[model samples]
Structure formats: structure tokens, C-alpha cells
Target chain A: MECYSELTCSLFVDGELTGDAARHLRDHLVTCQRCRDLVHALRAESRVLTESLRELPEEAPSPEAFSHLGFSWVWGDLAMMAAVLALGSTLFIWIDHLEIPGALEWFNPFSLNGLTNLMFNLSYYFAHGGTAMLTEYVAVVGGLFLVLLLGGSVLLLGRRWRLPKNGLGLLIVLLTFSLPGFALERRHEEFVTIAANQTVDDTLLAIGNTVRVEGVVNGDLLAFGRSVEVSGTVKGDLVSFAKRTVVSGSVEGRIYNFSQSLDLDGQLGHSIYGFTQSLRVADRGHVGDGIVAAAGDVSLEGEVKRSVDMLLSGNADLSGSIGRDMTVTGRGLTLTNTARVGGNLTARVRQLKGVHIADGAIIAGKRDVQVRVRKSQFARSRFYFRQALSFASAMLVGWLGLVLVPGFFRETTQAVGSGWRSLGLGIGILAGVPVAIVVVAITLVGIPIALMLFAAYLTAIYLAKIWVGAFLGWILLRPTGATRYDWLLGLLLGLLILTIVGFIPYLGGLVRFGIVCLGLGAFAWQLYHASRPAMTA
Target chain B: MIVEVEEGVVVEATSSEPSPLGAVIRMEERAQLRVAIAHLPENYRLPLVLRYYSELSYDEIAQQLGLRRNHVAVLILRAKQELRRKLAHRSK
Candidate 1:
């Protein structure tokens, strides 16, 4: 037989090998000294790696190892919580003082989907203190938010590293951007119009019934209206939230469109980030970057310098020159003869022919098409929103973790250092814990303990992803000096990817499961190794 | 791109063995590993640190670094070889 490839052997060591290959490798292992030696060396190095890291400065390490950030880090966290409380308390009190009834009608059971409706009504039934159900729901969700915030605070406080400069500003920006506002913004109610010859320099945040931008805007053009039209040139970004938006203008930057129906005939210097009901790019349009669109009906007859990624519940027709990749997931997809792709064309449609490609179409790269289950627009939107929420929350948690126990965070991630051993332990813990909880609960005497343990376990599982995000962040950002901000950037970038990946159909769930397993595995693996279970042995 | 160039430099600098032996192998503290890692080229260094230090699987490392799985293995192997040579040279 052929000598096992190093990649294969490496995968084998990482426990990423499968049935026949693994068996074959094992058989070869008995006969191959070189392969066995390689394996031995890998295992030995991994052990030494774990041991070497054990000498890292812990939050409370011995004198010789390294110094801890005991006081300053803790004080920084306390100071942050102080600020959050000072602001939050005022907001909470103000909200409570307000006599606004039906403002939270969106949270009402009837307004929610069937499942959430049922859950909300149940809470309403159990609001034993005669308080309004809406008030109670708000309070409960509010309490959960606090728990998440305080839990993050407590986690950060446990660490021993000072917060980065401008942490407060970063925190506010993260919180505000991630949390979608349900509160009333009456911008869409007014009838605003920018005349044909007008020129606006700054970004326009307008809300109106019928708004039209016909003049040049040096800054970003943002409008929320029933019928929004942009026929002018926007030197900056073009952001529109409307029922029907028609763009015939030129945008120097990106186009962010959140609309019911969109029609574009523009010269865009950047990409188009759109979430729409029906989207069409006119034949004259040109996109400098790529297109990331989630819409119902999409037809592109434009030019894109890079890739085109679309998650659609409706039909799609493409007639564009994609410089790189083209990934389309939808009910139906058509690659018109004009669609000439420089790279791969990956489509997950309802049927093989749900994606129709004309004979004139030239795909220079691979053409892969897989049929997929289509979800309701409502379901997909909700999923996207929840993912955004989860990503935001993880940022909060990771930020806290990085600040609190920077060393511990670093070490926990390094636990991934143990390779297959950590993965196996992670798998065992993730799969075994619930079973253990059930077994303990069967005795009834261990009920409270089991429940508490279960709660902590769940929290640990949630934080595992955050920890993984942090690890990813640290790896990506090269530290010029120990004084840094890369971890935060890494976390945001990594979690953003994780959240986006979690939106894919069948593959999304599988990817998330792998991440969870890896994270949980890394956490457990780190913990076990961190304890110096068999030091110097 | 710059990182890839660094890895090229490190690969050329490294000697025969993929890992160091003798006294240089005594990396007692994580700081020692950092010092050793500093010798590696930019590209291969992150992959090596991620694998040996972070305990990240080859696939995870690849995903994080945006490299192919097989490429990640090669990078790791090259990285280890370079690190071994650098540490040995340093010790001498």
C-alpha cells in the first residue's frame, strides 16, 4: 500500500479521520515505524505544550511564574459596571415612569408567531401578581438582559487584565448597533422631498411617507419612507428603508437597502448589502465589490467585481460578470447566457433545474448545485434577527472575559493545544453531561444540585462559543506589542462569521454543532489539562 | 501576503530536523515558546502557535487562517521544522 500522506496522518492525529481511512491507517501504523514515530512525536510535543503553558501567569500564579493583574483589572471592571448601572438605572426608572400603554404591543401574544405566542400567553397566565402581561414580559426579558450583563461583568471581574482604552465607547456602539430598535421613529410618517438641483453634504437620516432624493449628497443618504426614490449621486453610502425604493443614482460607497421592493440602476463603487422583498439591478448598473443579498425575488443584470451571495425564498435570475465566487440559495435560480463567472458557482436551490443555466453561460470554475429546503421569509428573518442578537451578546461576554481573566482566557483557548485529546474529552463531556444530570435527578435527593449544575452547564455551553470567538480573534490579529486591541476586533470579526454561517439551511446547523463541540471540547480539554492532572509524571 | 513571504524566509532558514533536540527542547515556560515562535516567519508562525499552543485542530486552524486543510498541515510541519532549528541555534 502507499505510504500514508502526512496530511492524512495529521488528520488521524487530530481525530478528523473516518472509518475505512482510519482502519487503513491503523493497519499501516503496525507496519510503519516512521508514521508511528511521527505520531509519538506529535503526542509528546502536545504534552510538553500543555506542560509549558501550565507555567503561564495565572490570575493567582506563584511568584516565579509571572505576575497577576489583580487590582487594576478588577477595579476597571467595577468601574465599568458602575457606569452601566448609573446609566441603566436612569433608563429603567424613566421607562417605568412613562405611562405608555400598548407601546409594547409587539410583544403581545396575538402579534407574535404561534410558538412565541403560546409561550407569552403562558407567562401572562402565570403573572400571579395582577401585573400587566406586557409589563411582566418586559420585566422578565429585562431581567434576562441584566443576568447576561451582570454575568458578563462577573466573568470579566474574575480575570486579571486591564480594559483596553475607549472600552466604554466600544461597548455603547456594540450594544446599540446589535440591538434592533422596536421603538417608534416617526421619520417615515412625514413627507420629505429633496429637489432635483439640491446638494446635501452630511448623511441624511430622514423618515417620511414619500421622500425623493434628486440632488447630490456628499455624505451618506439614509431614508425611511413608504416610497423612496434616489435619482441623485451619493458620494458616500446609500441606505434606504422603504416599501418601494428606486435607485437610479450613483453611490461612491456601499448600498445598504432594507426594503419591500428595490430597483437599482446605479454606478456603485462598492458592494450592495440588501435585505429586500423584490430586488432588481438594472442592466446599466455596476458594482465594484460583491453583492450579499437576502431577498424574495432577485434579478441581477449588472457587473460585480467580486462574488455574489444570495439567500432567497423567491426566484433569482443572474446575468452578470462575477469576478470570483457565486453562491445562491433559493427556491429557483437561473443563470442567463450573459452570466459569465470567473470562479465557482455554488447553488442550493429547490431542484437541480430550479437553477437554469443557458448554454451561453460560462462558469470558469466549478459548478455545484444542491437542492435545499426552503423556509418562510418570516422564519428566515427571525433567524437572522436572533443570530444578530446572539452575536451581540457574545461580544459582550467575550469583551468581559478578555478583560477579567486575560490569562485564563488565553489558557482556556490554548487548551485547544492538546489536539485530539481535548476534542475527545469535549465530545465526552458535551454528550455525557446531560445524561449524568438525568441519572443524578432520578434519585430526587440530588434534584436541586442537579438543577443548579444544569444551569451552570448551560451557561458554560453558551460561553464556550464566546471563548472560541476570542481564540479566533487572538489568532487572526498579530500583536505588535502586548498593549492591544486585536482581541476585540477578532471577536467581532469571528462572531460575525459564526452568526452568518448559522443562517445557512441544513449546513448551518451542522456548522454550528461542530463549533459548539469544538468550543465545549476546548473548554473541557483546557480545564482538565490546566489542573496539572499528571504534572512531572 | 506578507505573512506568506515570512514563512518562506523561515523555511529556508530552518535545518534538517523538524523539531529541536537536547537542551533547547527544555521550553519550561510559555514565554520560552514565545521567544522561539518569534524566530518563525509571520505566515507559518500563527499556524504553529494556533496548533501547538491553542490546541486548535488542523481544520479549525485552517478556517481561522483561511488556508486549505492540507496546506495547514504543510505549514505546521514547516513551522515545527523552522522552530526546532531556531531554538537549537539559539541554545548553541
Candidate 2:
């Protein structure tokens, strides 16, 4: 503690040290001039290095992102499904043997070879024995399932006690890892149930009026019934087509729900693709690849590993974790303070004011209105209020963008120096790109390519003003004669200027349009110049 | 370890060392550093790339690499040390 450690210095440089340690170090450095200087030097060094690294701009969208999600990804799940079936039949015969040592004992009934032969026969049945073996095993699995379900339901329902969610989730994760098979329940009248204690070896198809899965299904679960309740563990895809679907268990695969109302209070192994009148993914829910939810009032209180695409008529209340992009087409959207979206948010909301995006809701990606972008209703002087809000929002976004990837902003802003050239390039690109896209789309084969280019074009257009703002910020801050550019201040002043001027009438609109063209031109100029040498090389 | 060589060879190659905190954030420098990093051992490379380029936290890097969370920090520290050494060596 006498001398500040280099390890601490490194962590400090990375801004990782928090709370007491950071506080202590800062206090210590106050009296210790030498250490203060050292810390300063390290900060400077790391800042420069980080800035350079950021500029490397490695977060470029991968070409693979454009590729269609193909069937190749599900091949592993299918193979696992086949294996589960083989194991389930053996379990059935073993349980049957335990109950009655003589009844249905076709092999050498007392020996290990007898058990081995029984399993071998089950495998033969899985491969060639057909529907008979499947039907026979389902009866056994279904029987045990009912027994366990009834027992648990009686005890738990009687006590009015629910199992702890975390423990249940962990238990399901462990149980579902062991088996994979196809469980067939084609009863037209009976309410089919897969118990909590039961483990289905493979894919499950429960076709009944009301289906309840409370067991651990080792394979995919496909239930087509009036009401479906899944409280069990399905290690594969959970596909339900029912009037009301309630998933209160863990699914170690994608969930495809098509129902009137869908309630998810479980952990999803992969993504969710659902169409429902109303959907609620509860706080305890966790989805791996995000969700493609087309519902009425979708209330998401869960963690999504990727993005969320919501097509909803009613309100969307989101207070969860999103790993990437979130696109919403809804009447209203509300993001609680606890909500964190790691990537961009594009909302096509009917009214902007109804979309209550609270403080502490971290959206790492750009928050832009894709379609039907409207100014929120301001209680004060509507024109001035909107401008002020725009300035503040844009400034915050610009600062965060710079902090996240300084290189991108740095490069874009650099183009502003060649003012006329950049403006020319931007105009050319803005005009030419649409035509190119249209021509490409006509080919049909190049549709994806055209769409991708269009997306890029839109992004560039959106960012065009940002470059102009940054440039203006730079010029304003230049007189400070500081070596490094004060980009934050530049961005703020520029955004304020842009926003305030936008409050003007027809002239303001014309001015904004001119700025867009100029900004786009500059960006294109930079891109062209930047890529030329590399392309030639 | 190679300070003597750095003083004699690399010192002459560059006009002078930058101010402790005043290294210009240059694209060329990034390219040079990246090229230098490409020469590092595979074990060091992934952690460095993920830590800096990808901006992954220690826990995330650990999970992706299937290493213990604490181990990721250790790897990052070692990787930086090695990177600095290699950059100096390449400069020579």
C-alpha cells in the first residue's frame, strides 16, 4: 500500500476499479504527487491506445448476419431426438419388469442380457418396429407422468405452495440434458399430462383438448390442444398451438407459440417466435436468441440474449435485458428504468409521447423511429420544447456513440474538414444509391443485397447530420488550442444549433434538408477516399 | 529485458518517444499494433482481441473462452505485457 501497484494502475486505466478501492486510490493520490502523475500518465497512455483501438472499427456487421437461418442448425437437435426414443422404451420395460417379473417378459427375464436384449429390441422398435412400440412406450411414460402429476398437484395444490423458480429451473436444466425422444399422446378426449418427475426420451406430440407437461421432456414438445400448460423441462423446441398456452417451465430450445394468449414464466434455450392475442414473458423468463413476438399487448419482463421484434396493436411494457437490436411496431411502448437494450432500438409507435423510456434504461444502440416518426406533444411552447428535447437527446446519443466507438465518430467528423468535397460526395451517394438499389431489386436474385445496401444508405443518411455536428463542435473548440479535440462539446453545440434552427418555418425545413445533403456528401467522400487505397492494394 | 536494444535501435528509428499521455491516436499506429499483435501466441491473441477490439468484459471473455472469470483478467494482464514487449521488438 506504500506505493500504488501497477495492477491497480492498469485497472484504473481501464476504469474497472469501483467503490472503496477507487475512492481510496483517489484520496491517496491527492497527497501523493508522484503517484498522481503516474496515474495521469497511465490514463493518457490508455486513452490514446483505446482511442486507436476504437478507431480500428472491428464491430463491422458480419456478412453471415445477412444469411438465412437454415435447417443445418437443427440437425444436432434431430439426432438427439432419435437417441432419446431408444432410451425411453428401455425405461418402460425396466419399470414394467419391476412391477411384474413374469408379465410381458419376452427375453431371458432374470439376467443382465435380458435387460440388454430389451433395450436392443427397443432400439429396433425405434428404427423399424413402427407405431406399435411408440404407442406401447407412450402408455408407460404417460402412466408414470399422470401418477407424478396427480401426486404433485394434490400435495402442492392442497398446500397452495409453489416451488422456488431458480431451483426448478436448475433442476429442469439438469434433467432435460439426459434424454431425447418422441412422446406421442393422440388421445382425442382425455386430458394428456406429462408429469414433472417424468423424462421423455425424445420429441413429444400431445394432441388432446387440454395438455399439461409438468415433467422433463428430453426432446422437442409439440402440443396442439385447447389449453396447453408447460411446467416441465423440454430440452428441445416447444411448439404449442392452443387457445391458451402457459409455459411455466424451462425449455432448452426455441419456443413457437400460436395461441390466443401466451404466458411465459420460464427459461428458453433459444429464441421465441410467437403469435398471440396477448403475451407476457414474466420476470423469471430468459430467452437465448431473443423473441419475434407478434401479439396484442406484449409485456416482456425477461432477459433476451439477442433482439426483440414486436408487432403489437396494444402497449408493450418492457423491463428486461436485451442483448441486441429491438424493433417494435406497436401502439405504445414503455421501457422501465431496469430495461437494458445492448443494441439499436427502432420503434414504429403510433404516438411517441406514450412511449415512456425511463431513466437508467440503457440503450447502447441508436434509438431511432423507423416509420411514422412524430414529435411528442409538449405541454409548453410546442416548437421550442421539441427543439430543446431534440438537442438534449441528440447530444446524449452523440456523446455515448463517441464513447463507445470513438474511431467511427472520429473518422466521420474528419470528413467535415473538406467541406465542399464531402458535401458533393454525400449528394452524389444520396441520389445514386436509391437508383442502384432499385436496379438491383429488379434482378430479384440481388434482393437481399439491395435491401442491405438500402439499410446502409439509411444509416448513412441518419449519421450525416452527426458528422456535421461533430465538425462544428470541433471548430468551436479549436480556439482552446488543446491538442485533442473536445468532441462532446462540439457535438452538443452543433446539435443545439441544428435543433433550434429546426424550429423555424419553411426556411428551417429547407436548411435542414441542405445540411443532410452536405453531411451525406462528406461521409461518402471519406468512405471513397478511405477505401480506395485498400481496394487498390 | 530488451531495454538496451530498444535504446540503441528503436530510439533511432523514431524521432522521440511521445509525451507519457500524448500519443496521437493514429490509424497507422493501430495497424502497426495490430500487425504486432498478429504475431503473438494464439493463447494471448484471443483474449487481447476480445478485451480491446470486441470490448467484452472479463466475465464475458471468460464465458466465451470457457475459462474461469478471474482467469480472464489474468490472461488480459499477461496479454498486455506480451503485447507491449512484441510492439517494442517489432519497432526494433
| Model 2: per-residue Cα lDDT over B7-74, one tens digit each | 23533433365543334434456666655555455567566666675666767768777888667766
Give a tens-digit lDDT track for model 1, residues A190-304.
5666677877766665556677778877777666567788888878887776788888877889988878888878788998899999988889888889989999999888888
Name the best candidate (by TM-score): 1
Candidate 2 lDDT over residue span A156-220, tens digit each: 33222232466467446534542222124333334778777777776676656688989888767
Deviating ranges (above 4 Å) for candidate 2: A1-188, A370-537, B1-92
Q: Which runs of model 1 end up more than 4 angstroms from their true locations?
A: A1-189, A209-211, A225-227, A241-244, A320-325, A337-339, A342-344, A360-366, A370-537, B1-92
Query: Model 1: how far is A143 from its true place, Å?
Result: 11
Residue A198 shift from truth in candidate 1, angstroms = 1.8
Model 1 chain B scores worst on lDDT over the 10 consecutive residues at B1-10
TM-score of B-chain for each predicted structure, in order: 0.61, 0.65
**Would you give the TM-score of chain B in model 2?**
0.65
Question: For model 2 chain A, where is the 10-residue window of minimal lDDT?
Answer: A60-69
